[model samples]
Target: MRGGSGHSGRLLGEFRRTPLLVPLSEGDDGGLMTGWQGGVRWIYAFTDEGALARFAQSRGAGAGTGAREWEYLSILGARLVDAVIPTVDGPTGVAVDVADEDASMLFPPVVGIVADAYAVDAGADRADAV
Candidate 1:
């Protein structure tokens, strides 16, 4: 949860993407995705990975990531607007942000992590993200 940090504003602006800890296998290079109730074909990302980790913990049992390695992706918010199809039976919580001209809920693809082998320079530590 990049909880309204001083730097978060810049993050929210340049990087419209949020962080979600998917099990490394959920999304592919093409940005196509699956899962998340009713097969929404949507990519479920969070404001930050902490939010996602908390969510996973709340789910309990198999939902908890445990020691399993997960990968985070920063998807293109514009692509999401194009791919998200609306239907009466689909999941909720997503809408256009009238103020920003973006998905009300947005996330940036993960270019790097705190302890990654590769240097991504997301500009802040994961702890600072919260």
Candidate 2:
């Protein structure tokens, strides 16, 4: 499910517990975090082709539709970025970037969770596997 602002820890915890695939980034806005649950994968400030494709497929939207969803997703993404980047502990300066092509892939279970959450938030009657 979607979470409110200032709940990055909780959201990150949920992502870890559920084991969803999350990409963490550090940019001018702040720390950015994006994850995939179910079929839907979200990209915050970073745009990876693979991640975008997966998120689109889960939403049952063509490439075009998926692009549109990014607009809304980015809003939440910005908050996530701000919340987590500062907390990351490392010499990478907290505002690190983890966008490896192979690493971008989400596990199946995590994909399911993301998709389920998306459906619930969108008020879709059911979830669809992409």
All candidates: TM-score? 0.34, 0.22
lDDT of each: 0.38, 0.36
Task: Kindly list the per-residue Cα lDDT of model 2 for residues 13-89, writing each as its tens digit.
Answer: 44433312233333555333444434333443324445545644564656663344333233233233344333433
| Alpha-carbon RMSD of each model | 14.9, 15.4
Highest lDDT: give the candidate number. Answer: 1
Model 1, runs deviating above 4 Å:
1-23, 26-33, 36-39, 61-66, 83-130
Q: Provide the clash count, candidate 1.
A: 9
What's the residue-level lDDT of 108 in candidate 2?
A: 25
Clashing pairs in 2: 31-81, 32-81, 37-111, 37-114, 37-115, 38-111, 38-112, 38-113, 38-114, 38-115
